[model samples]
Target: MTERESDVVIIGAGIAGLTAAYRIKKLFPKCSVLVLEAKDRVGGRTYTVDLTAANGTDKWDLGGQWVCRHQHHILWLLEELGIETYKQWLDGKKLMQIGGHRIKSHNSNLPPLPLLSLLDLGRALDKIENMVKQVPRDDPRLSKRANEWDNMTLEALRDQVSYTHATRDTFDIAIAMISGIRPREISALHFLHYSSMAGSFENLFEADNGGAQEWKVKGGLQQVSELLTDKIGKENVILSEPVKSIDQTEETSVLVTSETGQNYRCKYVINASPLHCSVAMDYKPSIPLTRQSLANRSPVGHLFKFIITYKKAFWRENGFSGEILGNGGAPVIPGCDSGPIQLIYDSVTGYGNPALVGFYANAWQWRLVDLEVRKASVLKHLTEFLGEEAANPIHFIDKDWTIEPFNGGCPVNTATTSALSFFFDGIRTPHDRVHWAGTESATQWNGYLSGAVQSGMRAADEVLTRLTPEIKLDGLLQELDNKFPEPSSSSVRGAVVMVAGSAMVAGLCMFMYWYLT
Candidate 1:
């Protein structure tokens, strides 16, 4: 029943939307902006909650929390916001569990697997890495084997490349942790494209040295959005206002109606929500079937994240790195029960709250269980991996993003078979006046915090061009470009790493052959 006007309107007050608003306001201080969020919060996937420990209450991030040096945009944003970051605790022995309950501890990066399994894993990873290098960063469909790779699922590719059960299961676990989807659900081309976005498959999996999980923000990752909202002014952001429809009947302005009958009229609109949420809205002229199909094909990843705060860092005390990677009970495919966990990492708070975090990926069966049952299973698994000390925790918190109304799932959306190749244009192409700005629309670090920031900047740039055709690229936008240039091609880096890895694998194979003889 109420109406308002603004120069620009942004849907979803997550990092992407807020970043767009921030960028616009910074560039043109006179332009009015409004950000509407369905949930009663600012940060979308980046959630930071407090957990009570013996010492005091400390905060823990249950959502996207990791950052690396190579992720220039997010690192630059952290520096701009005066936020500090600490390296992820990764010293000491690490544990790996495979083939049910069989656990092994190793101090080095290599998992404690047999020589043959290790060699098999090395060859399989190298082969996949080579395939990933061929996928273009801007569009996966342009890859040489896009049609062939897109038609097959990642599970198919895994089966074809890996010779050992251990190698296959390890690859599955990594995929689950990275994408939050079963291997059978995502396209091989999509997986390769994701790897290319991170610069390489190794960067996606490695925890240090230009890897995705190298560092953690000191306070919480959510502070990025919070600080952006602060800079954008709290009055400019409206929460609990889910957009119902967008009508661009007027040639010069967009009319966005909320579920509560509140209307916002703006010159341009930027949709920064997940693909699923954007599909829920009713468009005036109707979105193209291709774009709608893109949303239907790209399903949000199902992920159940849990964090446990203990009285002390017992694993570290015992000289364990608090990092655990396991495939649960047994390897699994779609249409079958799966083990409850994939990976765990040291989640100690910045203020020294002893804690650990983990994820239940590709295990939809666990989602049906109650919190108590889920908590018990996770604690039991932790006890087996860490020690009896993990059984008792000061506080335990878990988030099943599947059930969240606004966000159907957490992390990111995975392209179904052939979706990336057939519907690639629907992702970033502007529909009339509505532009896209989610992490999924990014090119460099898609599905990551850095990606969200980059997409927002891109969207802001697009709108600036449309609004003032004569506007020049000077000021903050130009400064950012000069200070943090886009990263170099990952193919070059991946080739170097792959060569060294292949050499090591060949040497190991020869050594094992000689030893057996």
Candidate 2:
């Protein structure tokens, strides 16, 4: 087999890996860098499509469509890339559905409420504000507190709020759908962290270009990844080459055969793959016990995005702004004008004619994906909230994260109130020549596209620091291999058994909670 070399080798050409490669080349032009991607394409989870229309417009955006004003990394990148964004339209009547009843209001000032329930929600927001203020953005304690909250289910929080059955159902379903995790499975702390980052519910609802402040790239989001790839050159960025094993030896550092039986030798390796993917890949010198353990425990978030094309933004014609929120229930709680995904937005500026993007989370989606009878079910739900006309969308597309191979699931950070000190402190730390960078490893915007870029940039910085004259990369690689040897077959079996047992226990606990609670 042919052999190759580079100053640094990064696995996975997702946003994180691509960003790191670009930044490293910029910082140290003399250093040789190589990026190996499993897929033939770049942009891991960011996919954008251009659908030519009959009216000379195109429908698009398959992934990563929105950016908030507060998301500095993405905003800055767009500015640097010379991408323009338009304000999200928020002018007109908003719609809300609850218990199968649709409430239409032109007033944007206050949330419709049964006064008392609204007051309770206000009190809850106040408490959340206090919680956010107390948690520092960069504190080490953030992970610990987040874990603690993870242990307490969302149901527990609902209980604390003393919500009525209807109110509890509405809030729980809405929050679960937004979070993409079952209310009972998600930690309250993680929920709080999201609130803190978003600023408030109102802030989250207020879109920049439209609802969710979503923007379509004038060309496509793919342009961002393409720009970075152009800077790195085609030779250095290898595609359709997935790294199967990373063998670190005292004498030589080798990347074992990929699916195509090819190997690349490198002095240092940066693992930008997601935590679960990292676990699946073989490591000759082996990863740290802490990192392995965390990988086994990390929770995967479920997020689904669907795009529908209509002849026009018909809801607008009927005096509706196309934002809707609802409980998990079909007629009422599942639709929202702007809250629980009853939120439909205008996708005409960058893409084609009238298009609507729908997001679903938690059990609502779980049930939706499983139904043998899908189209009718979806139509029923849409018709209830979006009128009978919405039932016949011209183009329909959906992305199921669970079914994706490269990505086991949608992006999610450490659970709130769960012990993540080890994950952030030990697992994410650079070990000699090996470094970790992904959305999960980021401190800010932990589970977003912004976080992935930030983590990549930070990992590149760390690698540059280690490559300084004061530290010897070759010597460090040797020490790493000597200290961490590959496990024997018997040991591998034992480890697998241990992981299986832990998974069983965790599953049992989840089942019991679901059954009894």
On TM-score, the leading prediction is: 1
The lDDT of each candidate is 0.85, 0.62
Task: List the candidate 1 regions with Cα displacement exceeding 4 Å.
Answer: 330-339, 475-517
Q: Tell me how far the alpha carbon of residue 263 in candidate 2 is from the true structure, in angstroms, after superposition.
A: 1.3
TM-score of each: 0.92, 0.79
Worst 10 residues of 1 by lDDT: 484-493
Give the per-residue lDDT of model 1 (tens digit) for 1-517. Answer: 7699999999989999999998888888888999999999889999998789757898889888999987877777788889999999999899988765588998766766666677677778778878888988888888889999999999999999988888887888888888888889999999999988887887888798787899999889898999999999999999999999999999999999999999999999999999878879999888877678899999998778888898999999999999999877553433436556678999887888899988874557777777787787778777878889989999988888888769989789989998987788888998899999999998878999988988888899999889877776455544443453333444423444555578788999999999999
Model 2 lowest lDDT segment of ten: 484-493
Q: What's the lDDT of the predicted structure labeled candidate 2?
A: 0.62
- Name the runs in model 2 displaced over 4 angstroms: 52-59, 99-106, 140-150, 165-167, 194-216, 251-257, 331-343, 361-373, 413-417, 421-423, 469-517
